[model samples]
Target: MHGYAHDKDNYAKRLRRIEGQVRGLARMIEEDKYCIDVLTQVSATTKALQAVALGLLDEHLKHCVSEALAEGGEQAEDKIREASDAIARLVKS
Candidate 1:
């Protein structure tokens, strides 16, 4: 029922990949890999996470927020506020 339900499996797969990347990062540290190499992987992982976040936010705006706005009342306002807060959090991160 959530906005991302349609692509839940895809999201799960992406998260799993990210988890593996994190494990790789720990391994790199354990092995004393070059600092730049580890930092490069860190940047890659961060971008991947950001991509997933953007996808979920797009889905929320298209589905959940759209539906709430169509009803035209307090629910719409609440959803808009919630979405704004989410955007703000994303930006801060």
Candidate 2:
């Protein structure tokens, strides 16, 4: 099973909420809402998405990476490299 399998429902709910927030943003633009207010909402949405990403990464390291390590050999090395790449992408974002 995937590392996030346990919290899959919560993740879907959060993503749905974020989707609503994005749609709200589009509506705000259409309504010509105050610039600062719209920007603030955008920042909030970004942070929410980041929070989800970080949570997934933490779970991955704790579950997936740990399992791979226990198995040993090439699988362990591949998991490490994959996790490293994920972290790099997150940092760059």
**lDDT string, candidate 1, 1-93, tens digits:** 999998999999999999999999999999999999999999999999999999999999999999999998999999999999999999999
Candidate 2, 51-76: lDDT as tens digits: 99999999999999999999999999
Per-candidate Cα RMSD to the true structure, in Å, reads 0.6, 0.7
Regions of candidate 1 where Cα sits further than 4 Å from its true position: none
Q: TM-score each candidate.
A: 0.97, 0.96
**Model 1 vs. true fold: TM:** 0.97
Backbone clashes in model 1, listed as residue pairs: none
